[model samples]
Target: MPLDLSRRSLFTGAAGLTVSGLAGAGLAGCSQTAPSGTTDAAFPPGAIDPHLLGPAEGVALLSRNENPYGPSQSALDMIEYAASKGAYYANQEAAVSLMSMIAEKNGVDPEQVVLTTGSGEVLSAIAVLYGPRGPIVAPRLFWDTTALYAANLGMAEIQRVPLTDEMEIDLAAIEAAVTPDTGLVQLCNPNNPTGLVSDPATFQAAVRRMAATTTVLVDEAYIELSDDPEANSCVPLISEGHDVIVTRTFSKIYGMAGIRLGYAIASAETAAAIRPVVMSWSPCTSYAAGIGCYNDDAFIDFSKSKVTEARDMVFATLDTLGLDYLPSQTNFVYFKSGLEANAVQAAMAERLISVRGQYMDYNEWTRVSMGKVEDVERFCRALPELIEA
Candidate 1:
């Protein structure tokens, strides 16, 4: 399909704010108690080579959200076996078996599951399959790389809808942004950076509203770590006959960030459409370690518990510091420290601490991922001073 490159009309409506951060009334504080101490690892600035501070060190506070924990034990075991057999092409049996387990787990058909190097690859696949020169609607304040993929694929018109005053997606604006050229609609749950969820009703309504023409994408990369995993997912919408595709990642919940495994769940037809778009090699055996982790009952339960504990700890710390933060259901807290997020983030780095500086969209809010219990305590103590700095 040829790419479309014309600009669409500027969205000017109550819902078209074109940004994420907004102040609203009566927001209740998190229902958790604060922590103490400085368990957070120091990324002392000027101590380590500046080149070493990659995105990981720059946003160390939100490490957990980015799969800092690495692969689970079972995943490691699988990787060992796969590496031993590295002489061969990826283990097709392992891939099929992994897909089977994923399908069974998600209550979908194996045919409906498509593995990719990472969900990022899946997103790129979506752009290729659907990006034949039309307007694609996405939130204005969204994951930095999402729109880039579409635009790279020759998407001429990129419609960016803003967050509402309450910091949720304005579905009406999304609708208004859609035009005949509209081919895809991508949305994230408990959205990236800001950490707000659209709730079930709003999600269902948005999909229902978009079903007439567009292929709706629900990116649930952080869904597993969220407060209500089941409620915040779009899997139910797929089951209810919407033209929706839901993508989940093992990187976040299974702690296999290094393995780089992610899966997409959708209607069999949609999945079929996406399969051809996926890279030929598919996911490799080394990346299949996450499959082992997903299958480990003990590890899955423990991982979920750890996430919950960290969520409470971070939220409590945010409250004690008197910082305003988006209510996060995911593993990170998106809070504004009444300071330039980058500056405070830099100061934290000087203390050998890493926090995700809100760049691009919500620069005032810094997103800190939930860490070990002790880490949570250290951040609690250091945060007040950093924010005040």
Candidate 2:
């Protein structure tokens, strides 16, 4: 079936743009760099298809932020061992133990963390809990999933906040965008695509000024790769009794994406509020696998080291190309070509390599994920031709 990237949806954009108005326009005309007062939808419905690009046929450097090096051997061994228990439900004691491990690492109580299918699932849970018919504020240039998740909850009043020159969150603008109707505020720290991180002081100020009624969610999906995880997280906000949720993913630094484990750290009260909405049964076997994988401190440190190496390598390549990119603190880099990004992505695809497309700012920018060293070389080798052409 052909998917419709059209505006024929149950919910339309509020304010200046509608699903119908932005359907034919690129992301530039929408959130990323859309003119102020314009609320062009960032992603038209059904724009992405994982099936459209398969890993077996070619290297999908496009969504390459996925940890190319997956789980540690011990983690994989545990997964295989768990597979043998397929006939039975996993032990609840083991699952709780895994949750406790994550809580311990983050300095939170086990009861204050709720395990989910993945960090992505946690975002969905948030949308359902706070969205559906309210104004919400989020960074405009970001991973599209957050906005899509919000829209899925029937949110029509999605306000776009632009990134500052340094690619950090525009805290002043975010504070200004908040309205009484704003139900939630989302911050993707060490943000996806761009890999830019916000300083802690700015976050504190944002939380301080945010309407007391709005819940702030810090999606720390890539905090492990960041230079200062402690100073850049909102966990303190949750402890201070602010309405905050800090979501961490095992998929990235832990190399557990396939294992499908992520957890949200919050006040016990916030966790309790989200508990009823989480999927009651999250494939028990996966829980067992993640427990053993995340338990090893040595494995965690080693994985972080590797990601840091890849991040620095990619940044060097971007510099060599003279490509303008955000100073990445994550495993990926977002670059702007000052032209249509899809053209460059198509050019890379022609070489059997893929890069993500960005539709922001009426300019074409693309985001490339750092993979293994060899994959990075192939992408870099193919770049001059595309950029010069």
Candidate 3:
């Protein structure tokens, strides 16, 4: 029988489940914390410090490319409501509703959508599924989740094409690198670290050509923060039946990184092939947060404005220091630091600021995500001294 996916059925049935009864009978004994005998010191060196998981007070956190202004009031309210039924396994309904929303938003059928714990899961799934077929082709420097995961697992050979002299994704070179045996090609639009977006027409054409022979995975994790998301996205290509998978995340613009909800859009057949391999599903809170903010335009605009402001400030600082940097479309700014990337990262960490150090062979460049305006201001103030030091 087909599932009842109506909003009323979803919410009402979810609310009727007894959390206390379930928790008391089955979950009360479970613990996520360390066992009683374990201590923090028992962990090996480089284990994640729990204290560093959330925001660290007084620290300017610009390392991870996260939206600093997010989890809007609406998302928070929905999450609170969803938490009431947390003990119930609502994964099926939650996945359907979120997938329906994503499909509607992208102008695709629900069958063409595959939700994951995060976009990373889908990327990894694609890598594992296709890696055994043939080699994966990608730009030398882009968000490398799929290729790196496959290579590290000894599943696929990565064929890297260098970026252009201007440090932009060399679309032409990428197209030239594709062979009939190439199983997948990965593209990160408005790429991470560099924050450069390929020209839409050229990118689309290149993707279409590449898709004729192999599957292409476009990671649009930051596309919502770009100057024009619709124009920049390849979702329409999927609608046109291109063998392309475009993955998006609520973590960036929605400020819901902790929520862990994201998805992939593709041709129905392609989506089906990829879905079964995904290892995790998002929970109720993630579903609620995604439902609440998936179309919250006002909050999106506010987040974009603040990110632009912070990015411009970084550009100004780089200008004053006579440093070259890419004009960013995403929230982060990548700039020539004129120092070893590790040294720059260390100096900034000393000042209670966190920024990324290096990517591939770009050892002298630094990538800084847009934090709160005040924190960015602190980074701007400290940069001059750090460069001189």
Candidate 4:
């Protein structure tokens, strides 16, 4: 969908105008004072150190595919404003407005959009709702975390199709794997771990063919980072009234992973079915952040450029080391390490860097997400030594 210039201006203006007013509200009576004598001193002796819960300082965290620069200034401003109203439940009108904006941006009816805590909610909801109908068909190796969670609970059965020899998701194989009893078809474009994007035309055509038989869920979490997000998205299929559901997340592009906001576009009926199964509601702060940065093209461009720069560093290092890697269209690179995956992971950890070991049976391959430039530099520097060792 085309960017709404008027909306962009409004967002820019709001970010600039709200600071003093929000500060005044906090300075006045809005700020809450915590009760006295309620500090960490009251905690039990065995309580885990909060620091241990996250990455250690100076560690190059390249394991999780998160946008290193995110929640743009506009989002931060909006989040501040939203926090002042934290005592109250999120305004229903504002929630509706966000859905409307997303609907307008994606060229779908508001009824077709169901907002959730994150796209993970959409995946789990789909699994619970449709998994019992039959088996979920998906590529053998993709981001199957949520699907696997549902399967463990006995809510779904998944039928996996192996990737092509080139490590690309084989749409033909996935299509052939789907039968009359198939519950849903799950696809992650610019698929996770491999980072290979399917041709948009071919992808859409294949989805349409599969949607003819059963619902198809297209997880476009990283579509915005792909070469052509508009063409790569299967969202238009929903407008065409196919049994297709398109999921998107502000977590990846907007850098709002901790904030937890995502949504799905489907036929109004499908959306309705999915909404009931969503486990949690996003806060007003997250909604405000989404509204602020959803149209901030400049920030998106900046983030993508940084990701590209970091990815290039990894690529150049891999080239020098004679390592094989797939040409990536997303924010991470999957490469053949020529050593045991766990060994490489351990070696990187010993060097105070983090990278994924393997996925499924690709034991000699590793996936490293793009981190901050300096952090990626650390990974690149350590990789050569690890490989040589």
lDDT of 3 by residue, 256-339 (tens): 877777788988778767766665446788888888888899999999999989989999999999999998899889999879
lDDT of each: 0.67, 0.69, 0.81, 0.82
Model 4 clash count equals: 0
TM-score on alpha carbons, each prediction:
0.80, 0.81, 0.87, 0.87
Residue-level lDDT tens digits of model 4 in 294-331 = 89999999999998999999999999999999999988
Model 1 gets an lDDT of 0.67
Model 4 Cα RMSD, 1 decimal: 10.0
lDDT of 3 at 45: 83
The residue ranges of model 1 lying beyond 4 angstroms of the native Cα positions read 1-64, 67-70, 280-283
Candidate 4 weakest ten by summed lDDT: 8-17
What is the RMSD, in Å, between candidate 2 and the native fold over all Cα? 11.0
Better of 1 and 3 by lDDT: 3
User: Which residue pairs in model 3 clash with each other?
Assistant: none
Structure candidate 2, residue pairs in collision: 27-359, 28-359, 28-360, 28-361, 339-364, 341-364
Name the lDDT value of residue 363 in candidate 1: 65
In the order shown, the candidates' Cα RMSDs to the true structure are 11.5, 11.0, 7.9, 10.0
Candidate 2, 1-389: lDDT as tens digits = 22112221101213333454234222211233433442336336756444332264556454547676767776788787888887875565665677678778778777777777677666666665677546668888665564565574355356778888776778889888887778788778877767888777877778756837578888898887788888888887776777788898877877766567778888777776666555334566578768767767687787677767766776776788787888888877778776578778777888878777755662566787777667777877787777777
lDDT tens per residue, model 1, 1-389: 22111111101112321122112110111122333343335336536444432344433344437544556788888888877878776755666677788878878777677777667666666765676646668887766364565464354346788889877788889988876678788888868777778877877787778866788888888887676777777787777878888888776777765466777888877776776656435445545685667778777677778767877777887787777788877777778777888887788777667777656756687878776555666777788787665
How many clashes show up in model 1? 17
Please report the candidate that would top lDDT against the real structure. 4
